[model samples]
Target: MVLELHVWGPAFSLPSIDPKCLAAIAYFSQAVPKDAWVLVASSDPSVSPTNELPALKNGPTWVSQFRNIVDYLRQYSDGAWDLDSNLNALETADNTAFSSFLESRAQPLIDLSLYVSSQNYWQCTSPAYGDLLQWPNQWLLPPRIHSAAKARTAHLGLSALDLDAMEDQRKRDHSAAVAAGKIPANFIQRPRDTVSKLLGRTSHQSQFRLEALTGELFEPLEAMLGGKDYLVTADRPTSLDCLATGYLALALVPELTFPWLRDAMKSKAHSLTAYTQRMRHKCYGTAAVKVADAYPSLSPSPSPSHLPWQTPERARLATVGYTLINSLADNTPILSSIRAQNRLRQAVESSKADLSDVEREALAKHATGMKKDVLVSVAAAVGGVVALLGYMVQTGFFSHEGEEEYEEEEEEYEEEPLEIEVGEAPDAFGVMGL
Candidate 1:
């Protein structure tokens, strides 16, 4: 019987961006026969019984949660690896407790880093989903996902710091740092510099919050992981390893939203990083390389291809229009300087004879007129793009008719499960407790 794992497209060299999906991938990577299992990178949530990715279709059985999938594989599959098979009842209870603890404690940080942190969400996390979706969805889904993530973070009280307050605090800190000669006064101001430094700062409340959470969760994991191959002192990989590897893999990535989290993971939970790397190597092996190339569609699609316009001709027109708008939106002084230089060069080249003062004045006037004409042309192009987009929207060119048909087909496949076993899904951040 074939096993199919439905998961989000791979990103950041992991099986999926969602830690739960990564955990499921890690667990089943060891359990199922390579030929028997198949991975489907899909964005549609309607196919799953629970409307989530990382759901598994094991022959006739459908399991949605990671733990439920693990249980199903263990019960029915031959040669399925079970790390807790030999553990005593006491150790089993400890493993279960630790797994729950780790999930509850670490999930929020992951959420904060990937979604709440603007740097990671915009630059890294959101773009990761681009290729998995088509037009409008490729453009539309990310903001929705970002909004949902922000809402979740706000609900968790991590986003309680008011934006204006944070900005004011950051400015004060930056000013202080410059005065103290800690940061060069002339250092190039990057968009990420302030946020990065703020998150990295030891004294910042956000940093302290992150560190406290890191210590609470990772310190115990580090203690348990001392000289052990796996989190649970098991000779083989277990469910805990799957969960640990997921968060650890994400935390260890240098491009994570919170660099402090990466720094903390490396400095405070160094052992876990090593453990994660080892687990990755042992389970994935050459599959990682294959994943990178074979799953090109898993990466973000090229920007030009996913425009919402109906025809290639219209998309091309829109691209030109947008380019003109971008050029017009540049700093006025910079654009003025550029225009002045170009006018000077053209005036010099166009002069076939020594010009009188009046000729020079006339040339200057013509150049000024040319600049106005250029601006008018740019404005017209922008207006054209807007009008084109409005027409497309009115005509329903962006409507995804095929998606409705696809969903209809999916509805037929949504059958009553041969076996139903639900387990508490691992929360990225477990409930706060020791």
Candidate 2:
């Protein structure tokens, strides 16, 4: 028998239970054959229709507890189901519990669909959810990089409030409460201490600063995902995959409102945030009703400028080049020789120490050549890095000395010849083992 798995979280916001919510349910329900058993699991008790547990009465069951859902699902589908072990898989640490759940749910008889509460459906589907599939090689993952580092227009806004402002506001609120005899000075300090202790911070200032930092970083995240449904191979979606989209809606709202949340995200951490925003735009049709690419509707649309992922093509090209250079250095031998020629040309152009006309022209020609070479190297690099970045993005490898090390290595490599094996290659006739 086939088993369908559904995941739902508690209701707290507009995204908690909505069209995407229903789509998640239906999407997963249809992934498996009709003959399979269906199981719905929700952190929220009211996820099922008529407010009843599907697991208790329906042929397909609804389970409020994650462990119970795992137990029931394991019975009907051994190799077909793919679920994260945690009650709320998306909420688990580093998504490890979720990863374990997916590995367990893999079987031949179960077909999985997801009804998730978060907006990370795009990620959960491919690269993320795809990691746990019985045959992940069969799936086509989306673009792993979210273009966070790509060039684009910078529109600064007061949307971000500084730490000083937050502190002053808190102080003002505290003073007002104390003056009104609503609470003593110690009352405010007590909660602050409690929070500090719980969070493992020594002082309220440190904890609050951390919050402010997180908020600052995630502020630009919403703009990263304009509108675009991140499909898991355009049509099929596995369980926990849809949560990638759901997690976005959950994260975006909070990131927009809370400055600290933004600050908490750093570098590639922004990629996850960016991915969520892009997925929401894909599924929900921008900030407003999405007019289908094939249809025309007079719905109130979101601003064309207020897009989620709008990094320009040229910028994307540059980033692709940068990532390529880095990855090639790690996995290939030709990378060093190629980077040297490119860097030599760059040095000639940037050097303002003065040069004769002959030297200048020679340098100019060489730089021009390097630019073309860099462009080509970058293009070839794009393919390799896509695989690397896709995995890193999904598994959370954006943070580390890896990126920095890559940059330094590239810089050193730029001093070498960009063409290592070219002179060593035989004629186009492919003659001998020279």
Candidate 3:
């Protein structure tokens, strides 16, 4: 039977927005024969047993997550499709270690770029999700992903990168300025010049922190990759290479509103950038030409191209309802907690079964993210109910006992639009990438 790999759909002209999904794509592209399998960008994670994307299916059997999928694929064909087959025992162990290291170090950085960065998320990442998902999913997935990203990167102390956090800071600064009663200078501004300067400092600090983070991930990888096209051997890519390519390609490829990740990769580690392009072509073919086009400076010469893989399955009508149901289940307080608890229990139980340490950590992270999501959803639901009640009361639609109801004419007021400067300053990463 033909294998079916169900994953998140294309975004930013890449096969998948998710790194693990991209890793799976790369693995399949290199190892499995073209006719043996087909990719289904179903985008509905609910189909998987784990209710996660990047699920590989071989008839009745299924596997989720990147490492698990790789392990499963290798075992499926008597090592025929094993990319790491050439590696010795020690090399295989290193492969696993480096893969985990790449994930643990690289994930938060990716999160910071794609989700924590306000402008990037709104303008690029969220819109990509919108394109990949159907109606209700478009409404639901991005914010949860953003929340998860924030939680993952919370240790980095980079709340300044968040749009909501920044907006709140601006509001607090305005309040502080007004409270100080200093009509002193730059008063009639969205934020005073002084406040802007403060924001600029915070922005710089965040940039520096992000640079440090990028170095922590890329530097070691670059050293490990010293003069080698692939991570292990120059002959061909192994599982470790697939994992590395998945993470590095996303860092180098996507043209985000915040180009810090891409810029940092190009400037800080040229070899890694070139390695990513090589892997990209090997895995994605012409579909990844945009990756080269995005970084034309790095790739000045014309690059070879080949026929792209078949287009993935589009999100269908059923996907909309499926996402809605899952979203509701995920948001309901007690129900969500129970689900998360159950998931964690399952992860624990499956520790011995087949779930690798990285995949297990991911599942645990999902549980943590679910708790936060439930809290947010509860607050939103409560707030919406209160707002509806207030609207009804004001409109005299819902009368209160022992209270007079009256109608009043709505007054018109001239108000300029609230223009937000979503764009960062031109010299954004000036002090960083050293």
In terms of lDDT, the best-performing candidate is 3
**Tens digit of per-residue lDDT, candidate 2, span 91-171:** 445344433333232210011111110122222322332332122111311221111101110122111122223345678
Error of 2 at 147 (Å): 39
TM-score for each candidate, following the candidate numbering: 0.58, 0.27, 0.73
Candidate 3 at residue 234, lDDT?
74
Write down the lDDT of every candidate, Cα atoms only: 0.66, 0.38, 0.78
Q: By the TM-score metric, which is better: model 1 or model 3?
A: 3
How would the candidate models be sorted by lDDT, starting from the highest? 3, 1, 2
Q: Candidate 3 — what's its lDDT?
A: 0.78
Off by over 4 Å in 1: 78-81, 160-193, 197-203, 286-434
Q: Which 10-residue span in candidate 1 carries the lowest summed lDDT?
A: 305-314
In TM-score terms, candidate 1 sits at 0.58
lDDT winner between candidates 1 and 2: 1
Residue-wise lDDT of candidate 3 within 273-361, one digit each (tens)?
Answer: 88988888888875543333322234558444342233444557776677777789989767878677777867766744667788777
Query: Which runs of model 3 end up more than 4 angstroms from their true locations?
Result: 172-200, 289-319, 351-434
